[model samples]
Target: MNELLVRSGGLYTTVQDTGRFGYYHMGMPPSGAMDVYSAVVANMLVGNPDDAGVLEGTYVGPRLEFTDDRMVAVTGADVPVTVNGESVEPWTAMRVGAGDVLEFAMIRSGCRVYVAVSGGIDVPVYLGSRSTYTLTGIGGHQGRKLVDDETLPLGAAGGRARGGAAVPEALRPALDVPAELRTVVGLCSYRLTEGALASFLGTDWKVTKDADRVGYRLRGGSLDFTEREQPFGAGSDPANVVDLGYPVGSIQVPGGDEPIVLLNDAVTGGGYATIGTVISVDRDRIAQTKTGDAVRFTSVDLDTALAARRDRRERIERVRREIAR
Candidate 1:
């Protein structure tokens, strides 16, 4: 039961696990790590379970001091991580002794970074998750991002870990600009004119400053709805429909101009018409994209979405096998 002392809590650092699931119907969004792949891979590197809680950092990373010897790994963003100011490689497991300082440099690319220790963050689990939903202050350290001088508890490590455990080059995600996101087009897409739906797939949308764990609002795309009188109870706005459940990763155009892709901590349901959903696997890709990054959506069928899921699972299995080597 060692502790992790926070030296400088970098920009928006919070504890996250796989996610809080099955609570969306009550308007509680799953608050979890945005880049699921990176988070899981990081835990794997440290020989922890896939759902172990890790630190999620945006733009900057927190500086931490370990209270005891532990294994650690950094993943997601290609940022420089240092041990007591000495450079270390990322995407690989390393050992930290008691009183060792871990710090991160500015993000070189990508947005979120995951710091996984051998023992997961030991915050009391609520609703079966240790993830922090900061909007409502539900889980994690006070349901908020870490602050300077904060101390985080660590769970007991389930197994041993060796330093230098690495995820091979090919297995890493491409955080390339103009990330192409696979979307399953259906939902309430019927409300949009054929030309408008085409415009959505055809345009390269830019992530706006409004992007966050809740949702990503994109600019550079406008959708025109087919002419129709407002339905009973639906709002007068053309973008509005009967308030319905918004699937995680669902896309909605509020003003018919800015299209928002809901993410991990997004609201559960709203009156806005949802065009489609970014396939679950592609959500990992979108998570890495920062404000100002270019994004394009490509329509995919249910089968394609399923195939992508299988591919991701297989890749993860491969990483597990590699770590065992």
Candidate 2:
């Protein structure tokens, strides 16, 4: 029964849930929290369900004023949080009430942050999710990022979290390091010469400013394509393949140069020749990296990818248990 008044919307804050599913065939991307691990942990701190809607802040954090009492937590980045100008810790549940203003200082590390309140953000669901797909204006708080003075409604509180509930140090994510993404290379990788594939893994790519919800563009050493005639339906560009469904987290190099990592909000199908896919768990790692950061992709097998998926689930369970203690 509380309202969150957006005093400031920071850089690009959006309401996100687990994500929209089962619609990629129609070209709809699942627009959700880019850093699923951070989003889920933030919710865990506040006793919200893993898929509950939370605010995803990019770089800068939003300034919000609570209109009623609620429990809140911030996660993902090493940013300073405050209530009524008083410093509060991230990864810990804190109580807030009417007139209490939550603000963020400069981002010390990490690119995005997740904010979870007692009650999830109660935006109207679109396609079975409360995620915001800003490109086409669907779902979330009016299908866009929060702006100054916009009030967000909250549902019934889901947790009995009390103040001082802190996430264990080992359970929290860290930000100040080179980001590494585990990738499964194969689809259309034949387009790249053997040396190019090696270079792709050996190089440390720099994230470009053009990176956004849709996908991340990286600049590194050029990758060379193997000589071959274009396929029947494939485009003329060496990097082009027949238009096909892009698996979430797939990476495609255009002109055998910069690689693009498709994310949650990216087009489901494209003509680009995807050379690999970052494993599900490492998507969380790359999500924390901002423009100008160094990223290295390590090749892994499907077995390794599956193991990583399990490891991520186990880690989340660990957080849940620690919070329940």
Candidate 3:
């Protein structure tokens, strides 16, 4: 087996892939990379499978030394990176000599950075994924974040095909957040007061610092449905009771009259009233939002949402072709 040693593991470095699925019923949160699109892009750049295990780095990246020559790609947040002391850019495939050292600094734009190897990190998978879920100790590198002195498995390296990998110049994801995040009205929408639905759809909210793997808490105008109006009003939606199944993008209103948008590591079930769910297409924006960023939820008809998703997929495909060329 080839070796990839962590000489100096940085802050919050962990092994992640797409995520563990089909186990939420067993009370396992699908812990994975926060910016899944970026992660997949980096993996693809290195010619790895879309779900290959990669490194999810936050704020800083580890000091790593390779045991053999290999091709690698790093993407996601703009974390200053260097080989030995020289600089490197994100979204570019690079060759690392056996003794070369790679380092990453503080975050400049977003919070997470993804590093993907040509053949992907050679780690045993659990529940069909190699993502690290620190909360429950389930998948990924020992089911916890990587730390100093940790050794990771490097994929087979003898005479493997090597090539440069890079993101297409014209098809890079926009760093700017979109104006409105599309949502599908939920079953519990009726529980909220008449204005609650409209207020959530039209007004703006800011992302609070109180966000983490579980969920993002939003701060905005109070959405009062009153204690009396809620119990039976919005029935069977995400928020109506505790322990009901929840999907990733579920927006549930708790007692504070504010909604919390569930993310990648959100719980499988909860006791709250869900007003709406942000569609899968707009989840990337929610993943990159920083504290104090303004976000507005907009309701869109099913057709518009489907069309938007199609456009995004087409754009990504075009970019892939360009990069391949």
Candidate 4:
């Protein structure tokens, strides 16, 4: 195994894979890389498994010195990275020799930066993922964030490094908001009051400061729901609410009427009524939003949603075609 000695771990760092799945029934949310698309791309660049153990850094990235030569890629946030004081671009794979010092500054645009090493992080997996769920204290480097002096072991490079993996120039995914967010009106869409659908689809919302892996509390004009007799016995797990099975990406609006977009690490069950769910294609955009960023949710019918999915799939196919050429 190779070694990456942590010299200076920045703000918050954690080992993340594609995330835990099929365990939400046991009250475990899929807590993995926030930018799963970018993370997968980075891993693909280095020929690692799409769900390999990568580093997810918030606010700042970490500093590491390698024990052997290896290829690594960084994606997601645009955190200024440098190797021995020389600047390096993210989302591209590059070689690093032993004793090379890699450092990263705070995020400039997005929120999380993913660093994928050549042979994947050599951490024990739990519940089918290497992600850290800071709340439940499971998986990922002892179920916690990275700290200084943590030397993580890496698997052997396996002697394959002929092709350089660069972030596709045209496929640099945009994460900015105010762009229309596609949504499949939720299981609870019919509960909204008259005109509520129009208001929700046309309104602008800002992300509040209280944002994290758990959920995003959006600020916008109140979305009224036709009041009805409340149900009983809903137990909110992980976050503690009346029990109602909560799906990831479900936008839950409590009595306050503001929608809260649930993310990967969100609770399994909750009491708040979920009005809409941000479509999978739009989720990456939502992940990059920050406080006060303007966002608008667009209503896409089943047909439109299917078409959007097809368009994205075609884009991925195009990227593959270009890669093969």
Candidate 5:
């Protein structure tokens, strides 16, 4: 069978597609590529479906040897990629033969890198997705991060993939600048004092080491909550409220100090009072941010949020047209 022999599974490597849906009510978050735009572009470069399974490597990247000829593309992080010790440009599709080894250098900017192989990663799909949710161990390869010396199956490659297909520089997401996350200030936001809300938006929060697929914990300025009697079933902490469902991009400030931006693999519901939600498209910006990176939240209206999503869709469509040429 066609396969990739994992020489080293980097820091945290896993298989992920678009995401799993219809299970959030069961407390499962849609575990997928943190930078969906990058992941999709990687797949497109190799002529795979937009939601095709790809390898997501965090901080570091995996070393793998191909067992058959395949088309490959790497995206997301600004990391150096090498094929059999020779450097190669990222965001471009390249052909690899059996015995070809692929490797990555230390990340220069973004936290995660996506590798898309032609025919996609052939792992058993659970709940309509190949995403890995490591917390409960449900999907991906063995429901956890890939380990050293493991073998991953690959699907049959399609004939349409063209080597040397590259995404234009303008279309690629920028990794050099601090992230400015557009947020919709609403959900339970009344809990915060006026000064606290302003602080949350104005401060240049730094991403803490606790940032991951589940959530990104940030530290910058402290916030103050308006005093109120603790409601029944709610914890004594001022940031606590009776359990409420958390959207994928919700921001929750625990202890009125650090704010956690919940991501693809975050909990479905929690007692923490969510101050606002980062717009969907901006989640890609936050995903590329590494520890110590600065980020600021900008409050925007719902119409603006929807417009951003539309713009992203158009961008992806442009990529599709470009790669087809």
Candidate 6:
């Protein structure tokens, strides 16, 4: 069997696929690639299935030595990639011989970087996914971030990918600018005063150090909740509501100061009142943002959100066509 030797597992690196579904009701988040678009694109560039398991690296990245020939692609963050100490272009397929070492430099912009090989990472799948949910120690390689000197198994190569096949600059996500997340403002929005809602939208929020796969805590402006008698079964906190399901991407302000946007690894339910939900597609935008980055939310209707999803699907299709050539 083919294997990848980890020379240095920089920061946090995990194996992830599309995501595990049909289990969210049991208190498990999908725990998939945070930047789904980049992960999918990297898989495509390497001729792997869209859901093939890939490596997701946090602020820093990993170094690996290949045990066999393979085609590899890197995407997501704007980070420098090198093979055996020589630079290679990202968002493009590159060939590596047996013994070739892959490395990454400090991130230039985005938070996470994705590396997809021609053959998917062959970690044992659990609950219908290869994704790592580190909180519970299930799935992925031992259900945690990679450590140096660990060996990972790789599946057989698909043989369709060619070195130098590239994703066009126009199709790649722009990481240099502040993210403007399109949100469907509703749910418990009635709990906030009009001015508070306005402030929530108007403020340019900065991502806090608390940002992670579970949620992004942002700080900027304070919001005021409408006064109401605490309901039975609800906590005394003004932001508290009866415990309810939290849809991924839902925004909840626990203290009227920091708004947390829940992501793929967030809790399934909580008592906090969710003021809105960032649209599914825009979650990709937020995933690339790092600590200290600025982001703003734009209110939109459900129709607009669906349209944005369609646009992203079309873009992925375009990428498929482009890489096939």
Winner by lDDT: 5
Which pairs clash in model 3? 239-272, 239-273, 241-271
Candidate 5, residue 18: the lDDT equals: 91
Off by over 4 Å in 1: none
Candidate 5, residue 11: the lDDT equals 96
Candidate 4 has a TM-score of 0.90
lDDT (0 to 1) per candidate: 0.93, 0.90, 0.75, 0.77, 0.94, 0.94
Deviation of model 3 at 190, angstroms: 1.3
Q: Please say which candidate is ahead in TM-score: 1 or 3.
A: 1
In order of appearance, the predictions have TM-scores of 0.98, 0.98, 0.88, 0.90, 0.99, 0.99
Q: Give the lowest summed-lDDT range of ten residues in model 2.
A: 171-180
Q: Return the lDDT, model 4, position 208.
A: 88
Q: How do the residues 1-325 of candidate 5 rate in per-residue lDDT, one tens digit apiece?
A: 5798999999999999999999899998999999999999999999999999999999999999999889999999999999999999999999999999999999999899999999999899999999999999989999999999989989998759889999999999988757999999979999999999998999999999999999999998899999999999999999999999999999999999899999999999989999999999999999999999999999999999999999999999999888889
Full-model lDDT, candidate 1: 0.93
What TM-score does candidate 2 get on C-alpha atoms?
0.98
Cα lDDT tens digits for candidate 6, 172-281: 99886569999999789999999999999999999999999889999998999999999999998899999999989999999899999999889999899999999999
lDDT of 1 by residue, 64-151 (tens): 9998879999999889999999999899999889989999988888999999999888899999999999999999888999999989
Residues 171-290 of candidate 4 have per-residue lDDT tens digits of 867866575678888766666776877888888988888778888888887776665555456433212234567778788777545678899889887566667788766777777777
- As a TM-score, model 1 comes out at 0.98
- When summed lDDT is taken over every stretch of 10 residues in candidate 5, the lowest stretch is 172-181
For model 5, what is the error of residue 92's alpha carbon versus the real structure, in angstroms, after optimal superposition? 0.2
